[model samples]
Target: MKAILLHGVTAFLLSFSALGQMQSFSLQEVKVTGGAFKNAQDVDLRYILSLNPDKLLAPYLIDAGLPLKAERYGNWESSGLDGHIGGHYLSALAMMYASTGNAELKKRLDYMIDQLAQCQAKNGNGYVGGIPQGKVFWERIYKGDIDGSSFGLNNTWVPLYNIHKLFAGLRDSYEFGGNQQAKQVLIGLGDWFAELIRPLSDDQIQQILRTEHGGMNEAFADLYILTKNQKYLETAQRISHRAILNPLVQKQDKLTGLHANTQIPKVIGFEKIAMLTENAKWSEAARYFWQNVSQTRTVAFGGNSVREHFNPTNDFSSMLKSNQGPETCNSFNMLRLSKALFLDKNDPSYLDFYERTLYNHILSSQHPQKGGFVYFTPIRPNHYRVYSQPETSMWCCVGSGLENHTKYSELIYSHSANDLFVNLFIPSTLHWKEKSIQLTQATEFPYKNQSEFVLKLAKSQAFTLNIRYPKWADDVEVMVNGKLYPTSAQPSNYIGIRRKWKTGDKLSVRFTTSTHLEYLPDGSNWAAFVHGPIVLAAKTSTADLVGLFADDSRMGHETKGKLYPIDKAYMLIGDTDTYISKVKSVGNLKFSLDSLTLQPFYEVHDARYQMYFQTFTQNEFDAQKAKQRQQETEALAMEARTVDKVSCGEQQPEVDHSYKGEKSDAGYDDDGRFWRNTRSYMSYQLQNKGFAGKTLEISFSGNLKTEEVGFFLNDRAAEIIAVKDRVISVKTDNTELITLKIVSENGRPTPRFHQIRLMK
Candidate 1:
């Protein structure tokens, strides 16, 4: 929800050059005094406090030339993505300190910075990282011995993306926590990073950018601002991927089938560089990307993608079919993009999207009490989410989740040269020491439609007050001192009130709230109910919420519970308006349906729930019921007859199934289906315990080079006599474990493999 044209790009670009020269009221000027956000922040702070700082610091200490006082946590920490969460913790703690001035958080931030500083000092060359054997890895990469992929570089798990976390963390520590030592350490690390690629040509860096180097561009831009170094600025521009940004700037939507989270953060850096360099074309490109994603790509709850990739814009059936729904990290980055766009354009649409996403997605991602973080919020009917325990889970979502709640107070209030803009109604206080004004806002928000703002000043002053008019509200009312003020302000814009204001001046505004039906972005019949900005959902059942609290498994983020048939789930019978009208609010944020109670998604926890439901008219419902029942029967029969299956080329499945390969590559087709093939060979180890199946079935496309594929099972040659309907069914003897491999003749490539399963 950044900018929707409150001002043109020309005006913004013209003033952008001066942006680097001027500074706003320091971020320390505002603090979260009270409200839902403050409570959530407090909960996050408690969760962070429960984690042993020494254990979290183990990786940095190990990398920095210090002794580890604790063992590394399991799951991703013990896995390849080690040291990532430590970076996120530094950022979250620093942000929490700035937002609330919690002394404990400050101590934690200072401790982490000090530990990392020790690591940097010992490295002696401004090099500080916790990627296991990072010295050797980067040295190899520095010498141009690179083997990179989407998630790996030189056979290591995204060390660049991993280290970017620390770069951003150190920057946040210095910027937010005011650690002077962090600034020096941060610059040192940036210098090390810059010089690491300074020897390589832009072509080599572009090739390196193909890997998911999370926000290296944004981090470099921040460094440029910090030291005013031209080299860092050039490095930021060079780090950007032209493949993604070029099409976007030309308004070409080349984002289909691309990794959604990987690209959004890159576009955010594009916007930042646009503002810093006064390049309006890049700014326009970012705006287009935001609009494309927000309007077309996003779902009802303000989330986007399925299986962590952007599904086709013309089709979202994949979204409903998969247990892995919209990722929390995607929304977190989208909010960042929205905030950046909002700052330059003064657009209300940006804040509107921000409020919707913040409440419905970001706020809903955290476990309110048990202190865990949710990775994927599945929309599939009767499917549940898995929560990450602090000691076990180290997912990317967990890292972003730690920072999400701490950032609620970031946009509550912003200002101009003379005017004060109240962007959000979150109950917080903004102290403008330079202007001698202190504004305090208090509201129950989505539950209560009115918010009160109190103005306190040392003396009388003249300035304008711009309050946002949300699109969800109707007949927005503005009152000064309990009296109706005469002003006509349209929804989805800022309503300004300018006058000489004295101390203790009270301003109140009320927004009329109502419920509406939001459909899937593809214009499908499936829809979710929304009461104002909050997405309202019903708890369908709690049966079989497997892994509600996750184990320390690699695939713990996925909801592995049984997907109660979509056809059997709650069906909103009636027309769209009828469904909306029938939604009855029981009390507070809960709504009553026939067999379930609908509540805000953030409030519905630890249960199986339905956010989107199938809607149909009377005749359509009856007809679809019979057709859907048949499809369900066939689908279930197929599932019941299968032993174990692996989705080829998908990240989680490949790794979980022990995928091993040489000279192999993975990619998606135009229809967003992933496939993997190898020039040398590739294989997967799957389960076949107590199996009666005698056939191993492998699916492939008709368009691939399949004739020369040599099949092997348990290292024994298996004859694939002929292909039947694009599937090669190899007769096999049943065993406890099945090892399947596909090899090619000479150096030729194998066919694109889609799925491998054991079938009766």
Candidate 2:
């Protein structure tokens, strides 16, 4: 490995300087080839260009309404109207246009820029956003109106983050799309931000920093690079989140349970700042963060998190309990971070994480039908995916949903100043214009264990073709022109084959599969099952219980359980550990299931499924098998008559008191889900609704603590209290009765109901 010489701004400056000063040096250029199944940039641009930008942008434009023209934060009802997000779209558009010379995309960007310019002009200042309530929001923050005791701010930095996206878009337009008006608009926007913050005290500034803000510093650093302006660089440094960067720079591991994507963009800014300033400490810090996250925290699916927040390392057993795990947007951001590290160090380990995530998380996010996306990939076995709706559910998945399918061409191939690196084996063709070479890689990897690449040459040229030998491939064989060459000396590293290539040169690569158990880092004796690059999940019956239609409300709430404990009713095999009689091979592919019949989750789509089963040791395995047989015999003997219900010994408590307790001490029965305890003080059990209905009325014969009564039904809040005196009454009209829970305030415990009725 060669030593990295460039540091800080010097590194960026030197790239340009070297191109200008040295006769041998030239501008390092990149472009996508217009061929079938090429690099991500190519495939991504193709998909993006195909979309009607007007259709996508129309909703936002209308949503922004007058606030877009007024240059103010609009009503809280419309969040997408904020300028920052519009900027991101423009940036993505500009990049797509640069990658492919699409005139329609350029036209859409121009219209957006013109509208934003009008908004800025109307404000009589450089301020541009859809937030009409900006003044009121800031006032509330200054008045110390803290909500939920979490932070002291209104709407946080969401508006700012959105604006940053616009700034980035303008920057990309100028640098990549050759749009000068975009640059002018961005400069005006930057000036507005500088003036806005200049009046605030350091304490006020710190208070504002508590909210989640994107990479504002990185955008400024990019501005400095483009214009060679010192002020821009200074602003970039100032915008760096000291709270996040300070801890990371000190090599501290305080990232447990933190929002993954929220902190990643800040590190990207740190990386940019380090590149511009030539700060070795910053560079080391950025690298350390990337390495730690990529290596220790990731899952077999190449993603991290259990509920949109990072969990403790190796403790993924609890991942399946919630549907909100490993959000796709987080994976998208992680891949971007991976590309940055790979470009800097060209480490094979980075590629490993990239491939794993791309296959398991990113590819899986794309819906097979509508091209919509999933918000999270639940790691719980037997669970199906919950996809985002086209217009209704425009959450974080919406942003990533747009980017995910468009950029499959970007990661297929990368090049340094001289060498070509083929990192992924997606079906794609690469055209290296400078080298006069075209390389096409063809394979359906994980589905098939082999891939082949053919090189087409306008003329013979000398270059190194580096092929990645994936970490999962126990043995890899590389053949050129039907002759097998000795394997590369390093495992889990790229094999650099330097040769003079001409037209029709061929390379065939083969990867062998091997099953491995990955033990959890925690002291728990559990492990995740993996075969080759694919993660295997146990298949169970969740599909039949829920309808698979488009209108099915059960899609998102399908399988409700943790990953470890197998539900006895749903378990097809009596014991998960000893259930598999054999691991069989169908040609080159090998599969293992309970009773020799399990399949991968991706393969069992549209069917009820489960993955990740318990593995048992030899002693426990044989014992469980014998016990299962005995239970099977007993089940046969009991088949003569139906045993509908079983009863346990009942307990009776003696009550001697004749006096009645004060009715004022009892809380209101909101849905008849709560009642007074005759034996002791108040106590409550949250009730699960057995059926679906609309109206719920609770009647109680007692003086009620009206203010104390509250109900939470299906996680939606409802407050029902007695309006008058002794008789308490409450009612509500709702169709679904999932779970109804009631509680009291002022430390008074709620009571269990004696009689509960559901109204249709």
Candidate 3:
């Protein structure tokens, strides 16, 4: 049994709650013995073992002034987000250890804790981090020399966010791996952080929170639970971002323009803080956030956002058009939030979204045959996805992907007192050692509609077995030993079977599901075919899958292949009511829709596929086709004219351009675009390879005044030829590469820049 040693007092689990409503079983208690989830977990283990611990530990050692054991891994690890992956690796190892009891995972987890402890010891101030110039950076923050922006603090990339990964990893190491040293290191680090920020006012902390800080509040809350320390709890409360929380508490939808994953972790932290403090407002805020994202912002596959930013709830056109669709990290954090809500509220409805995301987004993220993590799961009709190579890719998704599949059994079965709640239908064996009851769930799940549960008890005991009837299922039939058992359970409710179990008892459930077309949340013509919780998509093509396996380049996770014209994509033309009826069963979990063959989205990989399709009535098909063609022609022509474009405030585009600035900040505009403005200067290096760039076009969120801003190409003043409709066009001489700089003239703040394009 894995247990956290809380000041020498044994806490049975990290999530142990005294005010239990519905509680999840520990990863150790439920073992996924068989099924697709088990396979995914096994594949994840292989990837986990393939990683070198020494390389991951290099960042810590370098920060601690220790001898080098190995060089740090490249990509994000060596980039500004240094040691972020290392932190996530620790978490993955701990959870995988607890879930699989894998000896190798435990070995790696122990090694990480030992190395981190050494680093913490060397600092002598409970401070250890891999942010470049680590000592200098913390010292500056300690002295209140803070320069905060959306993704940068003091001109460094997300230092708070980077460090929070370590905080989370350390917490998970103690909670899941039961590593005693981790608890001490975590407490020490918590103290160091508390004291470091002690001098700063709440306003300064809130300013720092503008950057993408992970669940720091949650980490402090976890520490408070572990040690019963008032300081940690106080720090957690103090650091909670009020700007985001206040709107949520008031039931306002202010999330559309925010960074999706960044806000998700914050909400998770909010939920944790609410749980610890029993703050009803905070709890409601968390629930409100979930409801908005899951109902309004989320897509058919339980993923949200477009290009890592939450698109406007009323307009999802960007989601269907962008190659950078919903990010994997968003759903990963969403699941964490959902689980917290489900456990707290005892609402089985939370499991509906959980199950959908688990089956579609999370399951489809990893390549089955060739184990690689995915960063973006594009919803564009024919655009493919890019998978992350273990050595080269260290995107945020890779970090979350490392932890995604390892603990599939975490929520299969939850309990309240003596009553057992089977929330998910995954095949797993649950050992309730406290009650001496062993229950095994066996099923093919979506492939087959039936699941069988067998129980083995040491002695006869009367208890309630509550099996969730998922929201997707129309109706469920329960049978005991091949005889019908009466059930009046409705969808999204649980059917409880109260009985006195013997040594051997059997309960079987059969469910009925129907194929349906789920339209985009914005009520657009685009829709995805969903059968129960499984989304069905067609493998459109395998050609032009460039960078299918990612390279070490900063933007390598993007699919740079040809984006097939949206107008030419396969569309459903006919009666809307007949779409579902036209889907003929070709095989199990596979269907034939006209000439296209549809299968479970989780089964589609290594190819360009279509999840969402535009539907049209037969009479209006020609007119819509003509309209789409006109739009596509203009879009494609503009794409062909562009040499390179930089999304000014976005993370990847700025990072890829070697973005540098002073007195610069970023924000999302009302029209659903990100913009960056600077009082001093901001510059990005754009490639003019082939010396084909003839014009520079800069777009702003507001009207641009030429007199207010100065444009320079490679430090030389550029001649502005045209300024019209928030766009400035400047003549550009042919140069192989140039640094484009935007300066605020006479100390006036520059107009918010939305995009910079180098046109040929």
Strongest candidate by TM-score = 3
User: What lDDT tens digits, residue by residue, belong to model 2 across residues 1-760?
Assistant: 3111221101011121121111111111323333222243443444445544444333334433433222322221133323443455676677666555678878877777776666566655666554436555534544555321011134233555555666777787776567788788788877767666666566565545544456788888888887788888888888777777777889987666555666777788888788789887776788888877777777666777655556666455556444446777778878877776666555666778887777667766655544445666665545666654433343455455555654566667777666676777777677777777788777877667778889998988777677777888888887777777664334557766667778998888888876665544443444455677766555555544332322222223122333222333233323444443344555434475434344443444454455544456656656676675576456434332221111000000000001122111221133312234322222122222343333334434444454665555555565453343333233433433334444555555443333223343
1-760: candidate 1 lDDT, tens digit per residue: 1222222111011122222222234557877767666777888988888787788778777877688888878788766778988889889988888877889999988888888888899999999888888888888878877655565566576678788889889999999999999999999999998889878877788778877888989999999999999999888999998988999889998877777888898998999999899999999999999999999999878899887888888889889977888999999999999988888776767888889999889888888777788888889887788888877788999999899988787788777777777778888888999898999888888778999999999999887677777888866887777767644556777767767788988989898888888889898888888888889888878889888888887778877677678788888887666887787878787888887888899887889889998889999998889889988788777777777777787665675676777677778887567888888788877777677666788888745444577889899987564578888888765787788988977677677888887886
In candidate 3, where is summed lDDT lowest over 10 consecutive residues? 6-15
Which candidate, 1 or 2, has the higher TM-score? 1
Q: lDDT tens string, model 3, 1-760?
A: 2333322222221122332488788899999988788899999999999999999889889989998889999998888888999899989999999999989899889988999899999989999888888999989988888888778888888888899999999989988999999999988999999999999988888988988898898989899999998989999999899999999999999887788898998899899989989999999999999999999999999899888888998899888888999999999999999999998888888999999999999999998878899988889998899998889999989999999998899899999987788889989999998999999999999899999999999998888677788999988887765667655566776776666767778889999998999999898889999999999999999999999999998788888897789998988888988888899997798999988999999999989999998998988898887888999999888888888889988876787787889899888877778899999999998888798889989988665677888899889999898888878898986787779999998786788999999999
Model 1 accuracy (lDDT, Cα): 0.81
Best by lDDT: 3
lDDT of candidate 1 at residue 259, scale 0 to 100: 72
Question: Which residue segments of model 1 deviate by more than 4 Å?
Answer: 1-27, 640-644, 655-662, 683-696, 703-707, 711-723, 730-741, 758-760
Model 3 misplaced regions, further than 4 Å: 1-20, 701-703, 719-721, 731-737
* Backbone clash count, each prediction separately: 3, 39, 0
